[model samples]
Every structure is written in structure tokens, then in C-alpha cells.
Target: MPKALKIAPPDDVLTMLEAGVAGDRVAFDGGSVQLIDAVERGHKVALHAIERNAPVRKFGFPIGRATRSIAAGEHVHVHNLQTALAGQHSYAFDTGANVVTPLPSTATFMGYRRADGRVGTRNEIWVLPTVGCVARTAERIARQAEARVAHLVDGVHAFAHPHGCSQLGHDLDGTRAILASLACHPNAAGAVIVGLGCEENQVAALLERIPQARRGSIRFLVAQASADEMAEGVALVEELARAAMAVRSPAGLDALVLGVKCGGSDGLSGLTANPLVGRMADHVTGAGGSAILTEIPEIFGAEHLLMARAASRATFDAIVTLVNGFKQHFIDHGEPVSENPSPGNIAGGITTLEEKSLGAVQKGGTSAVVDVIDYGVQVRARGLTVLEAPGNDAVSSTALAAAGATVILFTTGRGTPLGFPVPTVKIASNHDLAVRKPGWIDFDAGMVLDAGMDAADAALLQRIIAIASGEETAAERNGEREIAIWKRGVTL
Candidate 1:
């Protein structure tokens, strides 16, 4: 039988588990409703008649207002509904209804310990270009050094980006901060600072921020100064490889910094993958580990849920600003605050930005907001830290990596082929996506719908620990590692 799921008590629509045509019956908790219009799997169906311009409720919140009158059992989607959000609104800090608790510890993983006492899941040498001009040189250096260090390190790679030059103010400063933070990442035991001879992002300025203890392992090269850039680059890379070459030792899981993100989401995302990832967040935080959650825009509608779990009133205030400030970012551009949940998301049963946000925030897993940090800054909090960043996958992933995420858990329903510099484990929301994109998906949470969250949670934990202990994700195996900086300011 094709059944329907009502996520929350106040939900006015049901998400169909399987596709059904007109006259088809969808059974729920008590009675069954015959379909008045066809609905595809992972799409919505109205539970009752909704008048034109009335709020269309899903997940216990109004996703949007009906464009036209909607009959009971009719398919609810983009054609009949539209985003209700217009602009940003003032938010009040409210954290009264919450229980105070402490993060418990119980697990460990094998990792490399840096001189400054930070732990890393991978012991690889990284190459960073001050500008895009030296990107190829950096990659060439990494490719050559990768072969030499194959028997010693996890992997060697160069991060390439388009910016670092032809910018001013915060834009240029952002590039500098992100690159510097990546240079300081615990995962990279050593790094080569590649300069394009005259780029605004100078190696001297970059090197000034790197910890003095790790300076001996870092190398700086100016393309114009060297007679043979390739030779010079490779020589520097070789030095980095030699310094970074080390074996993984048993480290407490508390030392791990995990990044949580979701993209290409569907209705099942909240029902399965995101919640399971949240459970993983609780587990990690409970174990004294850190988990960073970004994509500020996606968490807009559900901002209150996290605010309620904030560790302090100051944290709640910061979160309110984080939410409102992002909303204003859209209004400043003359766009609607809830103008999101891409076409793929709409096809996957998301009607409005709020609907998408409600599902997207499930990845944070009911953890308290310990701190809030801006983009390009290394995270200092140990629990669930909210980062200020756009919802773009590459940009957000790179930001998380810069914030010192050793491993990133990326949940997707429509699926993504991209990966960040760090090991990215893609968790599929549906079993079909997992089956179709085996090379892209590392874990499938669809089984939760059939098996249960606890069982899926255990399986996911096992896979995460395995990856932390030196296992390669699908992204790493396919060599899809990349970086993207959020370019907010003008190019000039």
C-alpha cells in the first residue's frame, strides 16, 4: 500500500512515500484519503481542502500560501503554492525551555598529533597559492610530491582558487584569512605557501599568522624569484612531505572536529539523513568532540529550535543576529528572505525556503549552540558552532575545512559530485540515490525509514569512526577534492 507521512502534529499535508495516481488511496494513522491528484514519490499531498491564499502547512510550519484553492488529497507543489517570505524581521532571544547538560566521552580514533598539540585525521602536505596564477604550479608540485610520499603520508594535494588578487577590503581580507586558516589546519602537517610574485595576498603576511612552532615545516616560494618554478616548488613540497610523514596514533575522539552540511535535500532529508546526522552530532558533542554547522540561510525558519538549545543568553543573542543579518543580506539585494529551496528541492517536495530550512537544520541534531563564528575564522568552540556563510556547497565546505574540520559529513538527497579539501563523506537521504551514485555516496540513511534511527545511527557512527581512522571516502577515491572561497566584496 502507498502510505503517507505527516511529520508533525500540526502538519496540513502528507509526504507520500511512493507515487500514486488519482483515485489511489493513501493510508495514514487512522483512515485513508483517496488521491484527487497524482503525486510523485517524495512529493506532498494535501490532507484537507485549503482555500486560495491560505497557508500551506508542512512539518508543522507554513511553507507558503496556496496560489489557488487546493482540494483534499491533491498534490501540493510549486504550481499551487508560493513562498510567503518577503523580508527579514526582528528576532527576540528566547532560551527558557531547555535542559542544561554536559557532553560525555566514550570513543577514540587514530590520528596524527601536531607540535602545538592539535590532532589530525590525515597527515598530508598541502600547497596554497596566493593567487590563481600559481595554482597549476602548486598542483604540479603536489602531483610530483604525492608519488614520493605515497608510502609515507595519507595524500598530498594543492588547493586552487580563482581569487587572492584584483580585490580590496573585506574580499581580499577574506581570501587571506581563509588561506591562512587552511595553512594552520591540523590535518596538514606541513604546507607550501605559493606566491604569484605580485599578488596582493603576500606570503610574508600569510606566514606571519602561522604558528612559530610549525614554521620549520612550512615553505614559501615566489614564482618570479625562482629560475625554475617547478623545481623550486617540488623541492619545497619534498621538504613538506618529509616533515609531515608520520604514523597515526590512537587519539581520543574528543580531539576531532567534525563539520556537518546538507545540500540537494529532499523531504526524506529531515525524516532520515539530517536527523541521523544530528544524532551523530549529539554523539560527538557528548563525547567531548566538536561539530560545526554552517549554511546560515538554510537554518532561517528553524533558527528558534537551535536558539532554544543555546548554551547561554549571549549565544542566543548572537544566533538571533546571525539569522536576521542573513535575512537582511537577501533584502539588501532586493530578493526575498525565503527565496531558496532550489528547483531540485521543489521537485523533491520542498515548497518554500522555510520548508527546506526546517529539514536542513536537522543535521545539527538537537545540540546546544556553544558559539557563533563568522566566515574564514577558525572555530574555537567545541560543541555545535554556527558559522556565518552562504549556503553554496563548495564555499561552505571550504569554510568548514578552514575552521579546522578534519572530516566533513555531507548529506544529500539529489546528490553532489563535489568534495572539499578534507575527506567528505556523502550521506544519501534515499536508498535510490545511494544505489545510483555509489561512487559519490559514502553512506545511506534511507534504511532509517524501514529499520529505525538508532540502528542507522550506530551504522553511521561506525562508518564515521572508520573514516576518522584513515579510511578514504568516495570523494577522496575519485580525487574530487577542491576548495571555494566566498567572494562577498567587489572584485575591485
Candidate 2:
């Protein structure tokens, strides 16, 4: 073992060695000379054996239970330890809560305060179009408008998505709902709606879904009025930017709608960053705010766990219905949902959808699922919720931004350059990667994977608090705000 790496037994739980924990069988740094069974040298000591059916505890939670008897010094691994049961009945939030202790109230983040009692992390001007036909014109206008008024909002940008002009049924409704949510997002201090005058998504319908406060700060333009001219688009966008720059103020954590996501993961991701970010999610949600977890495909093989954590039976069922419905949609398209994993995921040691999912779900933390919404629906509940979106990090992050995520927590084992509309914090899987890619990785949670860091969970939670409260993350300093919207079925 390296001199800097050490391991200490957790004080909260006891580890049983051999047929029983006969003595103070401590797993510490640099001193061990007992062998009763077969074991590998490099593998983690988590494989040490004990009595049959013994429970494996971490973070004071029963992560798994041993399925077979084992001798001392033997590896306690997946082959012998069965995973903990995942179901609604397994966790009892009210009566048998895990953490009944109240958390400190001193925690807070400085954010942009909105008029209707919401908070924003960044001030931005949005140039949105009701139809794809106007997307080019909107982009041109945004570029000019941003240059004209660069000092006002954080940035002026256009979401050039390949949707809003085709299809039928729920797909159209999904697009309309998402676009409306974009217009009302807290990060958007002001907005300009550009339309082709005739498209599947009309400006009137989009405006109706925007909140009252947002409606007061928006401007409208039709390409027909500009004779479909590019110069007209730039002029209208400039006017909207000037108007948006006039309003700027401090916001609070309550105004934040956190977008949670994970990409290019490995086994250590669950053990490290995901759960750490989850702690942050819990804090944000507990502070009378909202957090959004998306990537429908990533949640595959783990929807049942989230359903069980739902605040109500209705919410649970709603999420369950979405999982099944999306699966059916994929089936209709002659593709398996399991095929969604990226090449990087496989190279980094992830296997099967179920195996990957076991860790992916940890990012939601222990918060109750307050709402289950379709793609593009603005988050309304004041706690953890599920957002409908594809597994692609860019697309899901974009939807979260559209639905109002002021910050995104993105985890990766295989480093990604992807950023988001709001600020993003990147957590690395291992210490080696964190040190090697200091420019991209903000925090190192791989200490949990190291030998000595016993309170991995607690330490990570503290780090998350620091990041959420204005601490610069690697992604933010690198200026990463990658956005992509999943338009699975049709443009409309």
C-alpha cells in the first residue's frame, strides 16, 4: 500500500473476521498477517469473510448481507455478498426514518432572488423559438444581442434544438411543455420569443405556460414581421437583451432548481461522487428548494428503488408508469434500452444495465421523490423529483436547464468535457484521475476508495456543501455548460 493511503475500520459498524469477530480485528495501514482462506493481494479488504448471512454495513446503512459462510481473510465480494433489497417497503421515512436528527439551518447559498419567490444561480437572457423554422434566425439574433449587451446578464444564448416543428400526440405536448418551461426558468432573467408565425408550436400557447413574473419580462417577435430577414432577428434580440440587462439582484438557495446527472461511470462512482452529490441534493431540497434527477435510460434497472422513496403512492406509480412507457417506446422502435450505455462506460468496467444502475441511482440521495414529470415540465415540488430525459448527458442536462436547473452535479470515471446551461461541478471516480485532470475534476472522492478515509460519506457531504455555496468547481472554471435535448419521437 502507498504511504499516503490508509484504511481504518468505521466506528459505527463492526467487521466480523473468520467464523466470528473474536477480537479487535482491525483493518489498518501496514500491519496484517492472518490467512484462513484464499484472497487476492490488490483487491479491497471489503472481501474479508465472516459468518453466513452476516450483514455488511456502511454509512450506517445495510448495503448488503453475506449469503454464505466464509473463513477469515477471505474476500467478501459480490460472489458471497448479496445486494440489499430495493423496494418501497424496505425504507420507512416517517416512522422508521434513517436520519431522524434535524440538520443545521445555517447552510445557505447566494443566488438570484426572483419576484414570485424563487431563486436563480445565474442571470441569463434566452432567445427561444416556438418553431424549428425560426431557430437559425433566433441563433443569429442571440449572437448579436449577446455582443450588444454582454455586460448585463451572465450570457445571451439560443437553444438550437432539432424539435418543435413535427409529429403528433404526446410528443407535441412534451415539446410545448418543455419550451414553456425554458421561458419560465429562473436563470433566464429576460427572454425573446421568435416565431415563424405558423408552426406546430405557437407563441401564444408557449406564453400561456410561462409564469406571471416571466411574462412581465419577455418580448415577442415574428419572422413574418421581419420579412424572414436575419437583420430583423438581430435587431429584435438586441431590444430584448437591453431590457433584460435592466434587472439584476441577489438570489437565494430557494431560487435554485438543481439538475442532477451522471455520465461515463465506473464502480467507484457510486461509492464516491454520486452519493456525495446526493447529500447536496438532500440539503438543497430540505432548504425549501427543488432538485431534478434525469436520464431515463440511466435509471433503468433502478426505477423500483426511486418509486419506493416516493412521497406518495401516486408519485411512485407515476414514475413507474414512465419507466415502463419509455421501455415500450424503445421496444416500438426495435431497440433495447440496455443499448444506451456509452463506449466509455464499458471500457471503465461497467457491465449489464442492472450492474450500472445499482450505482447510478445513488445520486438522488435519500430524499423523497416529490414529483414525476414528463420531459420539459418545470419542477413544481419543493424536494427531490424525477425528470423525463434520455441518458445522453448533454440532452438531459439541457432539459434540466430548460426545466430550471441552476446548477448541475455531473459525475464521471472517464472524464467528460460536457458542461451545462448553469454552473456544473465534476466529481472524479479515483484519486489518480483527479490529480491527473485537475483542470476538469473539481473534487476527489476516490479517497473513499483509498485505504484510510473512514468517514467517506461525511467528508463528501461537506465538499458538496462547499461547492453549492459558491465554491468554484473544475467544470465552472473551465466554462462547461453543455446542453442537449432528447427528441426521441418527433420534432413537434
Candidate 3:
């Protein structure tokens, strides 16, 4: 039976939420309680009045101190909980070491081992476009390739993105670097670099930049070239797919690059889902495997927590540099970082961006920050590394795979149907969503909150081992391949 039908939330909370502006009454404290002030989405309101200097609570934590006396049941949003006035305190790393014990025996996920010693959870050939102009052609080629060689790999997807041309300096360089990373992604057995002849980003330029070992496995095709003077890129992709499918074999556990991510979060996210994924990351890294945790915007308030676990000053500095860069990027555009938390997050009870970010960073667990790389930079080194990416779910997940993550563990609270071209296992942060979106979500880590549940960390670790060892993720089984790429500038 579907458990979602059974777990009903209090009608009062639901009513209050729907009522938005106009107040609603809820039975509480043996009487009906009335809301004094109505809150707009992405805004805030107080449940009760407080004296001057009193603290404002968000997500059950102190977001900021009241600047002055505030009336009860009044608005306690940006007016009271000031972002600048909020306390930005540091935390001690390894705080959960006492509770989370490492796995006893070494565990492994079945993966595709590459010639250069990288492990991939999915086996596919990505058709890379050197410029955005060729994305449509590349996508067509990928579709044709998948159709022609259905039995070759689990799936094939075109890395269709909005960047790779226009602008100058790091903007252009960033696109190229990211494209290089996608070509070298672990899930891809090989890649076909497609170009439209004349573009800022040329296929030959990429060949010169890519490492010799990576170039060995990649095939390139230009739309301008044809034996009959006709652009038959689809036929080219089919030929490449045949060659890629022929190079298939079992890659071991150590060869995997696990991408860790979370979205649609709530208070329970940090308490359950994030920690569970963290433990799994530790296990994968402990076995000499790689795991990626990105979304730089999401790591805003929690960078210090990660800094403390950094292996060295360089690694820590790298994390800091990325955070500062993102901060500056927003500031330069006159956008506040507080503008980040989505409307869904606000609806789910998250008040401030800091409060939301604190919970979001828990997905990385307690492993030492082994390395910090810029956007699209390949993670050659092992262990836990942070990639520079936006807070957007699909964009970050794509960045993670581009950085060489083989299998991905993505956690969500509000239930997102987002899946990657690679084998992305979606774990719901709460049971309510897990049961509701069974087709989109795989594991329910929400059981951690159930009464009498013993050591959720252990159960979660076991589930990770199972999923890595050939268990199909719900998203994979349902054929969900959601893709989105974050663009730097406005597209007119």
C-alpha cells in the first residue's frame, strides 16, 4: 500500500498556509488560535511579540537579534531578522564523529572502469558541442546514436548548454573548461566533439587543451565536413556510438566518482538526508573512490564549517576563494545572496538564506575537503571535493558529472523529478515526499525521524551500498533525464 495516503498533516497548518494574507484559525492549546499577521511568500512574519534585543528564530535557530521592540503576531521578516545583523558564527568540524561510525567492512559499487583508472556508474557516450550554435545538431546526433546503438550503453545524452561562445576572458574560458570536464566525465565511455566549423570555441582548440590520455578516448566531427559536401552529423554520431558501445566492461568500486547533491530542503534535511549522504560519501572516499559536492551558492553560510575540515591551507583557501567569488559575483550584479532561497524553500518554513544554507551544507558529511576546483575543472584527485556551480539543482548536478562523478546521490524534500543522464539516485529527505513521489525518489531516509528507529546512519549506509551494487534508482527506472544549464548573461 502507498504510505503517502496515510500520513496526513494537520489541517490547521495546511489551512494557515493556503490562507496566505487573510488569517485563519487553528485549534491549539485547548482553544482556537488566530493568526494576527499574514505573510507573503519569500517574506516573513512573527508568531509573537518580543522585546528589543530579543532573538529571532528561523528553522529553530537564531537568525538575528531584534533591533527594537516588536509587537507579537506581527511581521518579523527582513525588518527584524536583518541579514547583516545576523550572527555569523563558526562551528567545530568532526562534531558528528561521536555519532557516525565508519562502515565496518569495505563496501563497493559496481561501476565501469576506464583505461586511465577512473570508475563510472553509467556507461554512455556524450556528444559534446564546442559552441551553443551546434547544440541542436549535437542533440539530434545523440538521439540518432541512441536509436542506432540501443544495446551499447545504458543511455546517451547530449551535453546541450547555453554557453561556449560570446563574452570574453574567464567567461569563455569557463565554458571551455566545463565542456572539457563533461567530455572526460566518468559515466561517459567516450565522447564525440561536434563543431559547426566557425565558432569561438573550436574542436581543435579543445584537442590541444585536453590531456593526452583523455583525448585518446574522444572522437571529433565537424558539421562542415562531408564526403558528399552535405552535413550528416547524425550519421557521424551513429558511427561514434557503435565504436563507444563496443568498448564496454565492468568498472570496479574504486573507479566511481559519486556526485552528492540535495534540493527542495527543509529542517529535516540536515537532521536526516544530508547526514546519511555524508556517511555514504565517507565510505566511497575511504575506498579510494571520488565524490563531488557542488552548488557554491548553497554553501554560502556554511563555508567556514567546510574550511575547518579542509586537508590543507591551499584546499581551504580554494573553498574560500570560490565562496568569495560567488559572493562578489552577486554583489557586482547588485543582487543580495539572501535572494537565493527559492519560493518553495520559504513555503516549506525556511526563513532566511543562512538558515537554509546551514542545512544544505550537511550533505557533504565530515570528510576532509581534499580539493576545490573551479567550474568544469576535472577532479583528478580523489576524496571529497567541491566544484564551483550555481545553486540551481540541474546545473550543479551537471557540473558534478562534468567533474567526473560516476554515480550521483541527490536528496530532496519537496520532491523534484530532476534526474541526470547518468545514474542519479534520488533520496527523499522526508517519508511524506518519498511515498508521494515513489517514481521520482528512490530511498526514503525520512525513516530516521520515526520513533524507535535505531542508528539511521547504519541503515542509510547499507542502502548506499545496495544502490551502488546494481539496485535501480526510482528515477532511472522511470526514465527521468532532466537537464538544465545555468547561463551567465541574459538571453535576449
Could you arrange the candidates by TM-score from highest to lowest? 1, 3, 2
After superposition, candidate 1 runs with Cα above 4 Å error: 6-8, 99-105
lDDT digits (tens) for residues 266-297 of candidate 3: 54566567777877777767666777888887
Give a tens-digit lDDT track for model 2, residues 183-212: 787777777888787677777877888767
lDDT string for model 1 (72-175, tens) is 88998888988877666566666546534545757788988888778998988899999999898889988988887777678888999898888888888889
The ten-residue window of minimal lDDT in model 2 covers 11-20
Candidate 3 regions with alpha-carbon error over 4 angstroms: 1-52, 56-61, 66-105, 227-253, 451-463, 466-472, 482-486, 489-492
TM-score of each: 0.96, 0.76, 0.80
Per-model lDDT: 0.85, 0.65, 0.66
Separately for all candidates shown, the number of backbone clashes (residues 3 or more apart, or on different chains) is 2, 19, 7
Better by TM-score, candidate 3 or 1: 1
How would you order the candidates by lDDT, starting with the best?
A: 1, 3, 2
RMSD of 2: 6.4
